[model samples]
Target: MTYILQLVTAGLAVGSVYALIAIGIVLIYKCSGVVNFAQGAFVMMGAYLTFAASRLGLPPVLAVTLALVLMAGIGVLAERVVLRPMLKAPVVAVMMVTLGMLIMIRASCLAVWGPDPLAFPRIFPDGALELFGVFITYNYLTAGVLSILLSLGFLGFYRFTAVGLMQRCAADNPRAALAIGIHTSNQVSLAWAMSAGLAGVGGTLLATLNGLSLGLADIGLIAFPVIVLGGLTSLGGALVAGLLLGLLQSFTDGLLSPMIEDLLRAHTRIYSVGALQQVVPYALLVAVLLLRPQGIFGRKGSERL
Candidate 1:
């Protein structure tokens, strides 16, 4: 039971990071109707930025903040430079452009930061807290708490704020919103900026948890299963799905893998089943799509789209 609790805690921490990145993907999809494949690249870039800032003598908090700000600017620039021209293009074209953007960003990061993985500075105090006989690290606790807080704050913003309402309006119907005097283009730009900024924070959190590396961007791929399971248009769905996937992955890694391995050893010739946890989310994603295409919190009408 204690081991289970420990695994759960660890899963929640990693899942929270996925949820953050997933939220960014959902935000861009909701507002612009274009899937931003460059999200992983943004994560990679943000980690590099944080690493750069740390090298320049800034503390972790300041470095993360600076990285977020710069990422937001980069988001805006990406929208202006890469997306704006393709705004009138087909959805497939826009998506491909984003794929191109991802490649460009990855190459740029490699050129500037090089191909070596660097150790990220510790953001939280180095220690673990014991609760009910389970040891939980401050890094995990901080990341999980902060991710939840930020997600809730974003939810509140979407629920009550004027800017968020404008964003929603733009997302719901860009032409109608423009006809009604809202600046649709500006709203789209804001969405990209916010989405990129959130992705940056997620990246920083991940780097702090795991060491900094180009591979951190692969979290974006993990996020796809989260968003698909949660529904692409639903923020709340993203949160719940992220946490669920995280916990599930953790549990599988900690418990199920060993159990399955032992069972296989006793009964079959198979020696190992490697990284079963990584496969879980994708499997869940496929099941969700086939059985409940609308997702847990997704609106019924959205299934048509």
Candidate 2:
């Protein structure tokens, strides 16, 4: 039970990070109708910016704040400069542009920061908490708590706030919302800003847990399964799905991998499973795609011809 609890705690922590990124993806899809594949780049941007600030002797909190602010600016600039111009382009073309942006951002990071991973400065205070015979590090506790809180707060803002209502209105029908006096374009831009800012915080949290690295952008791939599982347009679904995926990963690492590897080695001559936890998310993605196209939280809707 203690072991299970430990895994669950770890899973929720990782899942919270996934949820943050997934929410950002859903928000962009909702508001702009353009999937920002470069969302992960914003994650990297935040971590790198934080790392840079730390190098300059800034405190962790201020560094993280600065990074998020810069990430928001980058989001706004991407909307105004890259997406807005080609707003009328084919969906595939726009998606390709986002992919191009991702590649460009990565290349730029490599050029500026080089390829080695940096030892991230500690953000959370050093310590551990023991509960019910499970030991939890302060980093994990803080990251998990912060991630879940931020996700919940964003959901609250989306559900109860005026700006949230406006974002929803624009997402429902941009043209109609514009006709009704809402600034649909501004909503789209704001979506980008909020999404990027969320991703920035997520990135900082992840870096504190796993160290800062260019490879942090690759976590976006993990998020693909999360949003797909949650429903591309469902923010709430993303949160749930992120937690689900995180649990699957944690269990796979803790139990399934060892069991399968041992069985294979004893009976079938296979030596290893080669990181089974990493495979779990994609396997779940495939299952979700085949079984529930609308996703667990998505609803079927009608459209007028």
Highest lDDT: which candidate? 2
- Please, what are the lDDT tens digits per residue for candidate 2 over residues 147-227? 999999999999999999999999998888989899988999999999999999999999999998999998888998998
| Counted clashes in each candidate structure | 0, 0
Error of 1 at 71 (Å): 0.3
Evaluated against the true structure, the overall lDDT of model 2 is 0.90
TM-score, prediction 1: 0.96
Error of 1 at 101 (Å): 1.4
Model 1 CA deviation exceeding 4 Å by range: 301-305
Model 1: per-residue Cα lDDT over 1-305, one tens digit each: 99988998899888888888888899999988888889999988898898899899999889999999999999999998889888789988897898888888889888897788888887889999999999999999999989888888887898799999999999999889999999999999999998899899999888889888888878888888888888889988898899999999998988899999999999999978999998998898888888888877776657412
RMSD of each: 1.5, 2.1
- The alpha-carbon deviation from the true structure for residue 295 of candidate 2, after best TM-score superposition, in angstroms, is 0.7
